[model samples]
Target: MTQTAQLYRMVMEDHVCPYGLKSKDLLERQGFAVDDNHLSSREETDAFKKEHGVDTTPQTFIDGQRIGGHDALKKHFGQDVREEGETTYRPIIAIFSVAALMALALAVGSLGTVLHIRVLEWFIAISMCFLAVQKLQDVESFSTMFLNYDLLARKWVPYGKIYPFGEALAGILMVGGILPFLSVPVALFIGTIGAISVFKAVYIDKRELKCACVGGESNVPLGFVSLTENLMMIVMGLWMGTKAFLL
Candidate 1:
């Protein structure tokens, strides 16, 4: 017996409901014949919503039973669904993963070796820049989240705004192997403060909070991962500073 599903989605001259399309695709993939119903205009969409007593388009029905929206449809099929504000390390993982690959590529291109110390340096520097970029996207939001746990941000306020730019500058300088004098101090100062703040917040204070390491909008928790970021900056600063003194 062939299973049948009905999908009501918005399809206008200037717009198409994305979730509606997703629902249709999912139904077909799951071996169901979808009766695709399109609400072609605002009037029709409103009418459909009123008739169904639903507030949104892209409603699904299986066996003549309402299955809700795309997310709801996924739930019906027992798929993992991510709710808003859920804690996830995806952003940090992606940033570091890409940074590692980039570092390897740079190392191979310049030194013809992937297992060199420079690769690690490049990885850390690239990751720093990427993290800074995330924070810089919305400094106000980042600062707000940062102040929740950062000691310096709580006291100075402006430090939260300045932190991303400082990290970026240090990262750029380190990557270019230029101005060690400036980069070393900036990295060390911010890294030290960050390390101390994260330590106090997560370990000593024992207050669970979202990390501003990725950005204000991130759901990344304040814990080992956040501490690692600060520690990496500190180590990079010290390593480069030592090299500068030696050379």
Candidate 2:
């Protein structure tokens, strides 16, 4: 019977809370007409919080009854609450999805025909570059994680730092159809090393960990995805190497 809800949320210059926006959207979606009250300054926010006896912004009320903050508002309305730091495969999925789209675009643009082999070639090249970019985002974090399982990185240490740049370089060269001699070796060596490392870690040692295939901060498991990535590189390397030899 409550058609209207009141929301008191922070909207200060330096401190607009994200939950406020979510709370507003939620209210609107649930067919509640919201009186969206904004505390537009630090003093106003603090005063409002003190008056309501609440520690957080985005306090919701229906019929003068306090419904609480964002999570509480959801709970009051019988909605499911998403927990913080939820693990998802979204990072790896996003990287591969973008790479696939890029590959398709290139295949359509350059050759005027979507050849299966060419599409595969582009996919591998773009995916490798994308993975390299992820690794490069936090190289220190990546290296520390990489050393846990990667044999080359565990021994040399510097290889962990250099690997991302090398992979990116090889991928770019492959995409450009240039310098197969350099690109092929780079891909083959690293891909082989990666496959072995993944095999030993997952199959032999039975170690469970997050994959550095997406990035150090990723939630992707350290098994199939990592193995697939390495295998793709190895296959692409061999294919490119053979093509170079034929020429």
Candidate 3:
């Protein structure tokens, strides 16, 4: 059995009982079998609460660790449960960055095949580079907007500090189209960091999060598609980095 499954078995004693009925339902939904008879007694529950620092019903115990009540459970399940107003622009930035690169590639290929002159290649390359830089700037601006404390829609999240500054730096490099050898590492690092930030923000803060990307207001869930985009950018960045610097 899974840890959550075992935890459910250990915590619920009477499925029909008032004390753990809600918790039992939640556990069942999470693929745990509920057997209330095996649950701790009322006196035992009080002691368990005291011993584990739990003062609420529907409290979860994951391998003896008190993961908290309903809010905690939702969080564990990757549901939206955060305080209001925690904004994240990582997705928007990521999408734009990839799109800019693709545009740059297309511009280069067209110029090389049609014009045949190296000058056209340089011109298209420069333009694409400029566009990439603009996209990077947009990402920064969006991230700043989300981080703004003055915005009422901005949430107070203490967890964003854990991400490294390297992520933003790497994004800047990708936009600048610099150092081909380092593109993969840069994109991967930035995307991974951004992905974690986005997921955590969405999962903890249960609400339709505003997209920081261009046209992000279209009402779309920032799900696996966004994550895949970042990963693809990393690959593209890596390829570009290699071709630009090495070949």
Candidate 4:
């Protein structure tokens, strides 16, 4: 038998509460019969809020007991409740996941026998370019955030502004397997500086902050993600230098 639920939500002339709609959908999806009690007027909505001691609408009740709002309903159903200002690995995971697929596709399309090292190089380069593009989208915002913990950005203001472009240039050059002299140094120099800065901010100083690795508009925390990016650059840069020297 389907469980029954009552949802009290605001539905006014000007607007209908989206949360209310979502709640109704979620309950029904979970095999619940939802009684959607729409508060058609502001007065009704306000009165309902006052009666239940709730400041918001989209309230849910299950089995004659108040289950609060959408978030509460999710909790009751054993779902991960993600609130605002929460740290998540979604962004970095998405970026790298796509980058890996792209590298694999490129490797498969290659005519000659594709070296494993070359495939790895391509993956790192592509990932760098993708991340750099995100930062370049809002350089001013990225630079401001970068200044909070990046040692080079703090000392040389211009470095922050130039960072995205430099990263992109290095990645692009590396992808084309050209200008190793220029790209290798840029990768090494910036990667080293970034690694040191992240270590100081996160480990040494033990300060919590946002990472500008993706850009200023991102919510990625200043820690593992940032460290991994810098480390990848350092490894790739060193590899490029050694390969060039050996050739």
TM-scores of the models, in the order given? 0.96, 0.89, 0.32, 0.81
lDDT of 4 by residue, 142-244 (tens): 9999999999989999999999998999899998889999999999999999999999999999999999999887788999999999999999999998898
Q: What ranges in model 4 sit over 4 Å off?
A: 10-18, 37-51, 111-115, 217-219, 242-246
Q: Candidate 4, residue 105: CA error in Å? A: 2.1
- Cα TM-score of candidate 1: 0.96
Give the Å error, residue 188, model 4: 2.1
lDDT of 1 by residue, 1-247 (tens): 8799999999999999999999999999999999998899999999988999999979999988999999999999999899998989999999999999999999999999997999999999999999999999999999999999989888999999999999999999999878999999999999999999999999999999999999889999999988999999999999999989985
Quote the lDDT for 128 in model 1. Answer: 95
Q: Which ten residues in a row have the lowest lDDT in candidate 3?
A: 157-166
Candidate 3: misplaced stretches above 4 Å?
1-141, 144-178, 200-207, 215-221, 238-247
Encode model 3's per-residue lDDT on 71-164: one tens digit a residue: 6767777887646545545444565566545555655665544333333323323333333343345444444433422122235343123122
Give the residue spans of candidate 2 off by over 4 A.
50-54, 62-82
lDDT of 4 at 19: 89
How many clashes does the backbone of model 1 have? 0
Estimate, for each residue in 48-115, the C-alpha lDDT of model 2 and write its tens digit. Answer: 88987888888999889999999998998798776665667778788889888888888788877777
Q: Pick the candidate with the highest TM-score.
A: 1
